[model samples]
Target: MDITIHRPGELTEPLRRAWHRAMDESPEYANPFLAPEFAIGIGRHRAGARVAILREEGEPVGFFPYERDALGVGRAIGLGLSDCQALVHRPGVTWDAQELLRACRLSIFEFDHLVEEQRPFAEHVTGLFASPVIDVKPGDGGYPEWLRGSYPGLAKTTLKKERRLGRDVGEVRFVFDERDPRMLRTLMRWKSAQYRRTGRMDRFARPWIVDVVDHLFHVREEHFTGVLSVLYAGDRPVAAHFGPRSSAVLAAWFTAYDPELRYYSPGLMMHLRTAEAAGRNGVTLVDLGRGDKEYKDWLKTRELRVGEGFAARPHPVAAGYRLWRRPVRGLRNTVLAHPRLRDPADRLLKTVGTLRTSHRADSDGAASGRR
Candidate 1:
């Protein structure tokens, strides 16, 4: 295999078409996060983003998108944001992991959501995770009928709640495809608040992440689209979601709801509505991503196994990087794997969050008094 590294923006039209063709040929590679457009979006904001193209007989055969730092430590492009990662290749094509890393000029390539079928990376994987997925089948009757049949209990209760929410609040409405950009901003704001309330890092705190989402919203192609779905009550937005979709797959990226309506379970409603709508819009599966959430367990028809690890070539930088990173990941994985451990960790985080919020409120009041 002949390898060539290029900035994602530098790829020619023929190379992009070849990348799409490779995805079309492999079911495992059919994710919008793995699409070339997504890489380009990241490359626009992230100077380190590059794609390593593999060629055989002078024809493009594979694509590996990654981000490398000055120290030679690399990560999958959109490392924390992308729910899928892989070296998308034609069927039966194979390559060495270390050789690919060398071609990309990397000492270590880190990933969290690598597809299980990528055998070349299998040896590098330290852990396997269950990424929940909802299999969407729009049969002769469509999503409504399928929902009733597949999850009668949930459908009955959720629909009743929807009715109650409408009667008590106002007309409850769900828009499968929302074109309004204002709603996108609303999602980020709510998500940012949610992060703070839960003692988590706010992704939207970064200007580049916000800009990247905005850029993706305008990307509409046959192979990839950024979809925004919203739920409302009497014109008041209560819940919203924004995610990327390929022709056959929709990844559940970001979803947020009004904190005031937590009792109504609007977040759950948003997901159910999105799944129903997504199936109708030519999406075959809704990837709920790698996490242990009750809602994911309640809704997923099945789960796909993903992996997290560092693929490295023997080097001081690679060894040092892994040594520093592995413990942090190990602690997180241990907590997630056991509810007994996860519960206490969650309580501690919530306490910290409560304290943080109150401190901010106090500071605001002090400033107001000064004014």
Candidate 2:
């Protein structure tokens, strides 16, 4: 096997075509996050982004996209934001993890959402977690029929809420592919607020991430398209989802709604509506990502296993990096894996968030008074 590393932008047209062909041939590799375009998008903002191409018998067989810092510490490209990660390769293709790292000049590579089928890195896996997904099937009867048939228990209540929301607010309507850029900004703002309220990191506060999302929103290709689905009452946007879709898979990425309309379960409503519309548009699966969320359990048809761990070579940098990072990840995983620990942690975060938000509000008011 031969391996060559290059910046994502340096990938030639033929190399990209080969990458697409690899994805087309394997369902496991079909995620838009694994697409060449997504790699390129990240590379535009992150100077460390690189791709390793593996060849056998003079033919390209695998692509691994990652980011490497000056210290030779590496991670999967778009690690925090990407729901799926893998060294996308054609069937029967295999390579050594150590060799791959050497070619990329990295002491260690870290991944959280590694695909289960990545056997070469199997021994390096620290834990496996369930990633929920909805298998969508297009129905001629539309969203109502699709919901009724797929989730009988949820159908009546959700539909009733939808009706109430429509009557109380305005006529409820859904747009599967909303083109306006303002709605995307609205989603980011709502998501940022949701993050603060829940005591999570505000991803939108980072300019690079915002730029990447905006850049992706404009990308329209056969293997990848940024889909923005919105649910509106009259002309008011109630809920919205911004994610990437490939030919067959739609990643359920950033989703947020008008918090004032939370009583109507607008977030849940957004997911259901997105699924229905995505199915009609030829998407067969909506990846809900790896997490233990109540809504994910309620909506998923089945689950896919994803791994988290470090793949490393024999180096002091690798050992030191692992020593520094593993405990943090281990602690987080422990909190998330157990409800007893998770519940208390959640409450504590919310309390902190509430106080933080109130302080911010007061500060704003004082500033306004001064003005």
- Which stretches of candidate 1 lie above 4 Å from their native place? 139-144
Q: Give residue 119's error in model 1 in angstroms.
A: 1.2
lDDT for model 2 comes to 0.96
lDDT of 1 by residue, 1-371 (tens): 99999999999999999999999999999989999999999999999999999999999999999999998999999999999999999998989998999999999999999999989899999999999999986656754576687678798888788888899899988898898999999999999988888888899999999999999988899888999999999989999999999999999999999999888899989999898888878999999999999999999999999999999999999999999999999999999999999999998888888888899999999999999
lDDT of 2 by residue, 1-371 (tens): 99999999999999999999999999999999999999999999999999999999989999999999999999999999999999999998878998999999999999999999999999999999999999999987978899999999999999999999999999999999999999999999999998899888889999999999999999999999999999999999999999999999999999999999999999999999999999999999999999999999999999999999999999999999999999999999999999999999999988887888899999999999999
lDDT of 1: 0.93
lDDT values of the candidates? 0.93, 0.96
What's the TM-score of every candidate structure? Answer: 0.98, 0.99
